[model samples]
Structures are given as structure tokens and as C-alpha cells.
Target chain A: MQKSYLMAPGPTPVPEQVALRMAAPAIHHRTPQFSRLFRETHEGLKYLLQTENDVLMLASSGSGAMEGAVVNAMSSSEKAIVINGGKFGERWGKICEAYGLEVLWLNYPWGAPADPAQVEELLLQHENVGAVFVQACDTASTVAHPVACLGKLVQKHPRTLLVVDGITAVGAADIAMDRDGIDMLLVGSQKALMLPPGLACVGVSTKAWEKISQSDMPRFYFDFQKERKALAKDTTAYTPAASLITGLHEVLAMIRQEGLAHLHKRTELLARAARAGLQALGLELLAPAAPAASCSGARLPESLDGKALVRYLRDTMGVTVAGGQDHLEGKIIRINHMGYVDSFDIVTALAALEMALHRFGQPVKLGQGVAAAQEILLERYPS
Target chain B: MQKSYLMAPGPTPVPEQVALRMAAPAIHHRTPQFSRLFRETHEGLKYLLQTENDVLMLASSGSGAMEGAVVNAMSSSEKAIVINGGKFGERWGKICEAYGLEVLWLNYPWGAPADPAQVEELLLQHENVGAVFVQACDTASTVAHPVACLGKLVQKHPRTLLVVDGITAVGAADIAMDRDGIDMLLVGSQKALMLPPGLACVGVSTKAWEKISQSDMPRFYFDFQKERKALAKDTTAYTPAASLITGLHEVLAMIRQEGLAHLHKRTELLARAARAGLQALGLELLAPAAPAASCSGARLPESLDGKALVRYLRDTMGVTVAGGQDHLEGKIIRINHMGYVDSFDIVTALAALEMALHRFGQPVKLGQGVAAAQEILLERYPS
Candidate 1:
């Protein structure tokens, strides 16, 4: 059986060390051993999130934190301006709407990141908006939303919390949530954390907490107050995902050992090589924004179906990639270079894409993409 | 570092193998590999829950599932009948109250099981009750709440779903969800599964489904309908705790390999031997009515504090026995012999307990507990 290399966004390829951590002995959550583990994890998460705000560690997916962000930060007293350009941005709107929060939507096409000017314009127009949700790098668009700029402008509206979904962005990008005026930065472990998705971490600003106290929405499992109280005791509000925590411990230790800046640089390098290689193959970038940017959406020639190409890459070349969701399915393909990625991975993925496109009868130059990627790598990185 | 053995009901010791499985690579939730894993896990969960109901999984702790049961399974047309005998039981009432549901609580004293007669009487008296939530075993009390009689009685009120919090009960005891006619059987992976506490799995019967549809509670993250829909698609409604799921895959495989029947017998044998050994050491059990079936919840002599004994167990012997909670603290030391345990583990725990007691100047004899435990094992196995 040919096992395809998972190059799509999280769950990213977990390091063997982290996976081993998860498979190790289960520690009692309340025991001193686990408390020390939990305490260390809390410290590590705060460092990753770049915040002094007490983080709410959840045992659900990224969306659970999204729901928590919405229910805890926004109330019926004011509307939330949801700038939806991608799937996750749309999700923020849907979750808030489900809780009966009035929404002021600023939607854009799926391919491009929402303009910061557009979001700032929306915030100004919708004065009643108490919160604004944006995806730092919306996975569907593969474009890095200008959250630091947008968050700064939203800070002007003190009542409007700048809630950013950093699910695919946080550890992959230079995210200083505290420095960026982000009120609530939510991330899942599966993506940039280089672990599985069972653990969700939220970086909350004091501004968000003040809103939480006054929010009339009925929040239970993901309640900030409950989570805060638990964190005060150096534990989770609920029995936490212990193995995931162990994985987190391992992943964090790996990152710390490697240095966060070094890890981020590696991801940037990987994304750069992937983008350079894909461009050389005559594929148009769906969003050619930055190395930190993901979805990493690319379009095949109009004659070739992107969906079919995704399968071809997987079925033939042993490289699993992502197909576009909703309207972009047959038009766009996503190549993920988020966590636990190295230069050789880029070579393997490019080789697969080249082979798969060749099989599709595309008039392509063999090994041209790999050569181009190597050229850029040689020029930029000594090794 | 003195590595301690976890003697808590949950976040129990993870099997060496399960920990290894959790350390596997993190895959994208949408990838074909994840699709295969999700499908395998969904099927594995159904078999483990012993129910044909839609066994939905969550990326949260067991408390999340308990909250899900409260917010999704019970209808607003009627009140929630909660049986509070321990911390978990009180959780049912708290969750119900959080959803603004009218709560009818039948609370029993600590260290005692909820009487089925009381549950039946409450259901009969309150015809408006839509559901009754109880524990199969109260870990805080170390008392097994017999669900056989409660299951039979709750059957009469088919509309009044019987929700069993089997967090500490699932693999530790002989509680079968389907055979017992349980509408909602909730289990946390951290306890009897010998895994960490990141995932919460629930057995939702068809009756529970109908009631869920009628539920007026507003929920997004814990919504059963959304989760069930995602389950049908062989994916989680949210990004799951993939590491936890990976760990779970390994743990369940081990369980199925051991077979449920044999596991139950081993657990019973271990529990019996441990309890008998403790009793022979002159420790009096707190649950005089039921022999404290799963965990050996016994009070040390007045000269010893359970808390200090627990500390000594950890500090001196590397055995982390649990001290009683609430008013029971310092009075009773609960020795856990749940998942990932066998004869030697119980013997080690018993010997540790005896040594800890001896250090406290309370123990009457040496090797007495081990000798008694040996006799039980010999008589039971006859080998």
C-alpha cells in the first residue's frame, strides 16, 4: 500500500517524538506529576501565544474556541462584524449567528484575503459592533489577512474585540497576539503546533475578559470564567486531554529546543520553496502573499481539473494534498507547508506534483520545478 | 524524580502501548488517512460503548460529554432529574442549571451509592422529568452505583432517558450501555480506557435523539445534531483532539484484543483482591453497604491522616494513592485499581498502603495485606 505524504494543513505531520509522547503513560490530571506537566504546558502555551493573559486550554477543536470566543466576548447588546472571505471566517459568522448575536457581515470572494481597509470601513460603519472576527491566514484563501493592522484599527473601537482565528497561522507565522492588539487569538494544536488537534488554546486579552463578564450569552463547557478559575489552580476547567497535553509538552520542548524564531524561519523556508517550485511548474498561485501564508492555494491550467489533480498527486505520486471547498473545488488545489516541514519535503512534494501533472498529459518540463526550487534554496540558504 | 503511580480514578495510568500510539504522526483531519482513522474510530467507539446508538465523540474531557448530555439529550418541556452522590453526580445538576433547565436533584451522602428506589420514586413523583442522570460508579466515593435496577426502572419512562456518567465505570466495571437500556452512556478516555482525558465519547440512543431534537437549549460546540451529522460523514463536527484519538485507537485495540468479558473479570478480581487485602490490614471500608466495589475506599486508623498517607505513598513509595474529597478527606484513602492494572499493580498498591500506614504507626502487622491478597488471587485463579 502506497502511503501518501500528508502535505495538507493540520493535522500536520506530527514529529515522531510528539507521537511517542501521546502513546506514553496516562498521568493523573490532579496528581503532582500531571500538575507540573499542566503547569509547564500552560507556560509553554503562553509563550507560543505571546500573551500574559491567562490562556483557556480546551479539549475540543479550534471551532470550540471559536464558539467560546463568540459566546464569551459578544453579547446581544451589540452586533459582531464578521469579515468573511474564507471558510473559517464564514464559520465565525455562523457560530455567532447560532447564538442569536446580531451580525454585520463584510464578505469577500473566497480566493483573496479580506482587505484591512474593508474591515476598518465595516467597523466604522457598524458602530454597534462589539467584536470583529478575522482569520489571520484563512486556510481556504491561503492569504494572510492583515490582522495586526485590522486589530489595531479595531482597537480604536475599544468595545469591539479583535478576535482572530490563528488556527493555521499562529506558530506558522510571526504572531505576537499581545503586541498586535488582538483581543482573542484562538489556535488548534493540529496545525502549526505540530501535534494532533485534540487541544485548543486561546489567548485572551483583558479587554476580552471584561466583555466576558458582561456577555449575556449562556456559555457552559467553554466558559471563560470556569476556565479561568481552573487555570488559577493550574488545571483545566474540565479533565483535560492528557495525552494531547503530553504531546504539547513534547512539541513545545522541541520548539523551545529549536527556538521559536528558528521554527518559524523553517516554516517560512519550506513555504517559500513550495511556492517557488509550484510557480515554476506553470501553476498560478491562488494567493501569492507570503511564506507565512497557507492554504498555499494553486491553480492548474484551465484544461486540467484541480480536484482530479489533487487525487492524481495522492493516487499516483504518493503525495496527499487538499482540494478546494465549495466553489473552488475543480479550480484550486492547496499545498500545505505548515508544521514539521523541511526542505526535502518540498522536493518530494514538487517531484510528485511534477509527475502527477505529467501523467495528466500536461506539456511540462521534467524536474524543472525541483531545479528552480534548488536554485532559490542555494541562493537563500547555505545548506 | 520519584515517578509516582496514579491511583486516581481518572487520568489513570496509560498503558505503555496506548501512549506509543498517541505518539503517531498528526494527519490533516480532511485527509484520506484521517478519513480512514475517523471511520475506524467511529466503529471502534460503537463497539466499546456497547450500543447501536449514534456514538458521537468529542474533543473535550468527560465533563464536556456530561454537559452535552444535559444540553442536548434532555428537553426543555420537562425538568432534569439528577442523582447527586458524588462530584460527578453534582455535575449533572450544575450543567442542567447552567442551561436554565429546572433541576430536580436527589442527592445522596458522600461515599454512598444512589439508591435505585430513590431514582424510581423521583421519576414517578415528577412526571414532568424528561431525563435522569446518574453515575454507574461514583469515583469520589469509590462506590459503584448499581445501574441494573435503575436501568430496569428507567425503561418504564422511555421518554425519561437514563443517562449514565460512566467516566470511572466504563472499562473498570461490568456496566454495558446497550444491555442495560441506557439512553446516554458517557465515558471519558482518561479513566478506564487507560488513556489521557482529552476525548469524551457518548452513546446516544434513538430515544435520546428524539429528545435532543426537542431540546430548547442553545449550544454550538456541544450540539449533538451537528456532532451526529459530522459522525455520519466520518469526521468530527470540530477539529478533534487527533493525538487523543490516536491514543484511543491504540487503547481500544488493546481492549478488544483482551476482549471485554475477560477485562471485566480481571478488574473484578483485582478489585476484590485489593479490597480484601486492605480489609485484612485492619482498614475499615467507608462504603459499608456495598463493599466499595471498584476502588478500595477505606479509612485508616485515627492516628493516620489519609492525606498524609497519600503523600507518603507518593514521596516514599512512588505510589500516588488518592485522598478523599470534600468532608471525606484525611479520613479515607482510595486505592485505585482501574484500567491498565493487574495482580502485581494491586499488590504493589497494597504493600505501599501498608508501608505508609506502618510509617504512620497505625499498621498492626507486616505482609498481612499481601498475604491476604495472595490468598484471594490463589483461590480465584486456582492455579
Candidate 2:
């Protein structure tokens, strides 16, 4: 019998208790019980987002919330700056263009960290830019963007709102939304929240709400104003995804119990271990400039089909890891260490990678990667 | 100690097995394991939607899918017919208006059904109408529109695509999308899919795809064409709610084992029982023309506050039900019987309502509503 290990970037493993909460009977959205639950979830999200703003909960995917930020923050004819470094960054430009906004795209090479100095130059060029759309960490490239520096820089310009898509960054990193002067910080539930997808939380600053108040973009279901009004009453404007919220409450409690600093450190250690393991196996890091603490992307070894390696890990060993996307497809593989994951998960992924590579006709030591990961983990976890 | 009973219109109780599956480690989205799971989910949705057309999965709430149908099927300078009967029906107009479509509104009473003949007249009057936006069942009023009749009526207009927001109807009722010529049938996972509220599935007809191809409306995340192409390879266009999809596999398995006819009959029987129980308590049915089998909305009896009644039931007895929206607030209460629920749930809700009424100085005979519901349930489910 083969045991399964899931190490995907977004839909990471959910805690056992959290999953049990999701299975519990759903409460009515309009009832007092749900209202109380909703309030707790709202407050918990604020804590998770590290913001004083009333984070609005949406029954949508991360992309929907991303779209909400664009439409709510700027009108159709306004100008915006988009940092297009990877797949997710390109998404910002796409959402902006879809809404008829004039997007000034700042192209950065994939697997390369975004340059804050270049962003400063563009912001200076476009004085009337309504918002600056960016990803805190481009998940596809596994590169952590310099959001802290960018946020500090963007705060200098009062006219532009810094909207960060922290889908894979928020729970995995220590970039504080309020402290960093981020106008809008968006996250999906499936990532470090240790819950399933279907819920998105966006923390909006008072400054962003001011712009949202004046924006003329057409919106109804994703309207932030309606969400804010309902949020004050401890409910959602529409029916909130009840089970996911319940699960989120449990995950947030777990995060609280563990403490955010500890959580971030844990993820960082796991990421470091994975990186050490891949380097031990003679694999090149895909994003060496600044790797995300959530996932590690490594170039595929010679004579190994990236797709075949991933398939062998899943089918032969029952371990799931992600292959690269777009241009990097079939050339790289990503191992995730986010949400409900620990050092052992990294060991399993590395061990599976070694076995799969061996099966794919590569000459390598069986436990070299896992041994390298263990050495790093032992120093950090000390168990 | 209070035992909880979920009787909400949506976000219904999830089965234990399904919840456990959702809590399971999330597999990689692009892996063969997930591809097979996705393929099965796609097939299961087609079966649930009762449509031969391909069902596209989305990572948004029902409203997002509703918006997808609107923006993907019609351009900005188009005219559409909207049936405004209740909150959900009015949502059709809201979405259409948000996207800048000229909507010919057919206003019906909030609790009343749409007349097919009047719709025919509107179709004739507005020959240039490109689509008809409607809800199979308006959850706010618990009114199930005659979608089969409307679909047949709209089918006559070759240029007009029939878009039905079957958020609470597709799995609860027996309307066949292909058989009725529904161009677009949208449903949320939080309803009868027995899952959380983050995923939406839209089944598109060939005619709808034709209109979608010609639609010049700018779309990125909710793009149906991109979704179709990705679906052909057994994956979603964007990162799908992976855990929810995992839970969905379990829920669909349960539905298949029980059979659709049995599932529908069970919900119909539960709705009938709830209606009988409320009527026995001297409460008026909100939608007598055609009530949705998913929920039963009742006008509160004398000396009862709708909001207080719902709150008391939830806070005191741990039984959560819904209060009405808009003008119906504090006047109507809705008892849900959708998805992963049965006769016992209706009885529990009725008993709670009776107890709450007694506590609130209203003369309520204890067990009266429960007894009435038990009789109907026994007659239908004589095991």
C-alpha cells in the first residue's frame, strides 16, 4: 500500500481539525450564530493580514478578489501601473486591460525578482497612475518580489494605491500590510490559511476606500461598498461560503496558536531545507535572486522529463509535486512548503524526487537530497 | 449544551465523508491524479445539470458565474430581457446593468412566478433581445420559476440565449438544461453539490457558445472560451478550489449512489413536509404559485418577529434558519432542505421554531409542527 503526500503550492494540506470544522453543519448567513462566526472570521483575517482595516470576505477565488481590487479602486479611463514579472503578475495587466484601464506594463524577466528602483522610475513617469498592481511573490517563478521596498516607495506617491496580490505571500512572509503602507492586500484561503479554496479576503486601507468611493467602475456582486456595509453588521453582502469560513476559523485559530512569527519561521525553514536538498542533488534553483518561503522551484536534471518525473512521484510513490508553467513547463518542478506542511513533507518530496529521477534513468544517490534537507531541518526544528 | 441544525438555503450540511475528503491533502492541479478527478467532476456536473453540453468549472461564487454568463454571451451595446420577481431574479438585471446592457425589465411580484405568456409578448416586442436572464428558483422568495416553460418559450427566439441562474434549483429540481434548451445553466457548489461556496459550474449550449464567440465584452478570469480549452485537457483555466473539488468527488459519489430521482424526491418530500408543518402552525406560505423544493419561505404568524424568531431559534436551540432579504426582512423566515439534508432536518427546524415561538410569548402547541411534518415525511418515506 502506498501512502500519499500532497505538496502543491496553493491547495496545501488542511489541518485535521480544520477539515472537521468544514464538514460540520453550515449555519444560516442571516442568523445570529452565523453572524458571530462571521465576525470572528473577519477579525481573524485582519490579524492574519496584519492590518487594522476591516478586511472584506468574498465568496470568490483569489483572481476574483484581484478583479475586485482593480474595478473598485479605479475607473475605466484611469491609468495604472502593472508589474509583469511572472504568470500572476501578467494577470494584473490582464485584469486591468479587461476593465479598459490604461495599463503601463513594467516587464521583468520570469524567475527574477522585481526591481523597486525601476518601479520608482515608472511611478515618476506616470504621475496620474491610480494604482500599482503587483504580486508579493510570483508563485509560478517562486520569486519573492521586493514588496516591502516597493510598498515604501509607493507610499511616497500619495496618488497611487499599492495593490498587492499576496496570494502566496501573506501567511508565508512577514510583510505587514498596514506597516508596509499597502492600500489593498489580497489573499486566497487555499494557501497559508490552511483551508480550501472558495474564500478570498481583501484588507483595504482607509485611503483605498476613499478611492473606491469615487471610482465609477460598474460592479454589483463584487462591490466593496456593499461588502463593507454588510461586514459592519457581521455578515456578507451575499451568501458567504459558510463551510469554507468555518474551516478558515479553525485554520486561523491554528495560526494564532502557533503564532504568525513561528508560522513564517517554520515555512522559511522548510523552504530552506527544500532548497538545500535540491542543491545537494545538483539542481539549479529557478529563482535564486530571492526565493519565496512558500515554495522552491528547481531546474530539471538532464535526461529527466519534468512531466514524467512529476508523474512518477505521484503514481509510483503517491507523492504530488507541481511542474512548471508556460515557458518553464517541462523544464522545472516546484515543491511547496506552505500551510499545514512541515519539514517531513519536504523530506518526502525530495526523497520522491530522487526515486523518480532514478526511475527516469538518472544516476544519483538515493538519500542525498533527503539527508541534506534533514541536516537543515534538524538545526531549525530540533526535534 | 445545544446540538446544531443547519437549515440555511445554501451552505447546507456536508456529509462526514465528503468533509473528510475536503480535509485530505490537496493534490497537484496539473497532475494525472487531479486530471482524472477533474474529468470525473466535469462528467458529474454534466449529469447533475442534465445537459449534454460541456459544463465549465469556475472558482467563484454563483454571482460570478452569473456575471460570466452575461459578459461572455453579450456585448456592451446589446439588449437583454430580465425577469425581476425577487432578490435573485433582480440580480439578473443588476449583473446585466453592471455590464452596460440595456435590460427590458419584466417586474413581477416578489413572491410570484413569471408568466410565460408575458415573456412571449416581451420576446415579440423586443426582437433584438440577445438573451433572457432569470433564476430557476429565487432563493430570497423561495419561488421556483417555470424554467422549463421559459426555456421552451425562449428557444423559439434563435438569437436569444436563455440564461438560467439555477443556484438552488439544478440539483434540487428536475429541469433538464439541454431538453429545455437552456443556453446557460449556472449552479454554485454550496447548494446541492453538497460542498462549500467557492466553485461555480456553467453548462453552455452550442448556441450560447456561438454568441459567446461573437461577444466583444472584455473578460479575463471568467472567460468561458479559455475555460473550455483547459477543460478539454481535464484542468481549469485558473487554480481551482482543489480541496473543494476533492470534497465534490465524494458528494457526487453520494448523489450517484442515491440516484438523482431519489435525491430529488427526497428534497421534494422534505419541502412538502416543511410546508405542511408551517401551514399547520397557521403560517402563510410566501410562494404558493410554485415553491422551490430547496427551501420553504413562510410569512410569520401573529405576535412573532421574523428576525427575533430566527435569532431565538439559533441562539437558544442551535437551529439556524434564514430571514428574508430587502422588504421581506423581519416578516418572513426560510427553512432550507437543500443538499445532504433530509426529513429529520426539517423536523428539527420545525421543533426549534415551535420552541422559540413559545419562548417569545406566542401561543404555540409543542410538537405540533413537528408532528404535522412527521406525518408527511412518513407518508413519503415509508421505510
Task: Highest lDDT: give the candidate number.
Answer: 2
**Candidate 1 lDDT by residue in tens digits, B65-130:** 898888887766679888888777888999898888899888888767778888888888887888
**TM-score of every model?**
0.51, 0.52
Instruction: Report the Cα RMSD per candidate.
Output: 25.9, 26.1
Clashes by residue pair, model 1: A11-B28, A19-B23, A20-B23, A23-B19, A23-B20, A24-B19, A26-B14, A59-B59, A198-B241, A241-B198
Off by over 4 Å in 1: A289-292, A379-383, B1-383
Q: How accurate is candidate 2 locally (lDDT)?
A: 0.84
**Residues A1-383, candidate 2, lDDT per residue (tens digit)?**
12356788978887778876887777877889988888888888888989999899999999999999999988766798898888999999998888888999988888898888888998888768899898888899999998889889988887789999999998998879998889999999988887889999999999899989889998888999999999999988999998998898888878887888988887888899899989988899999989998889999975667887787666655678889899888889999988877644665577557656766677756556765775576554221
Candidate 2 residues lying further than 4 Å off, grouped into runs, are A1-383
Candidate 1 lDDT by residue in tens digits, A120-155 = 777777768888898888888787878888877988
Q: Write the per-residue lDDT of candidate 2 for residues B1-383, one digit (tens) a residue.
A: 11356788988887767876886778999899999999998888888888789999899999999889999988777798899889988888998888788999999887899998989998998768889888899999999888889988888888889999999998898878988889999989998887888988899999999999989998899999999999999999899888888888887877878888988887898899899989877789999989999899999875567887788767655668999899999889999888977545665577557656666667666555655675576544222
What's the DockQ of model 1? 0.01
- Chain A vs. true chain A, TM-score per model, equals 0.96, 0.98
Report iRMS values in order: 26.6, 24.3
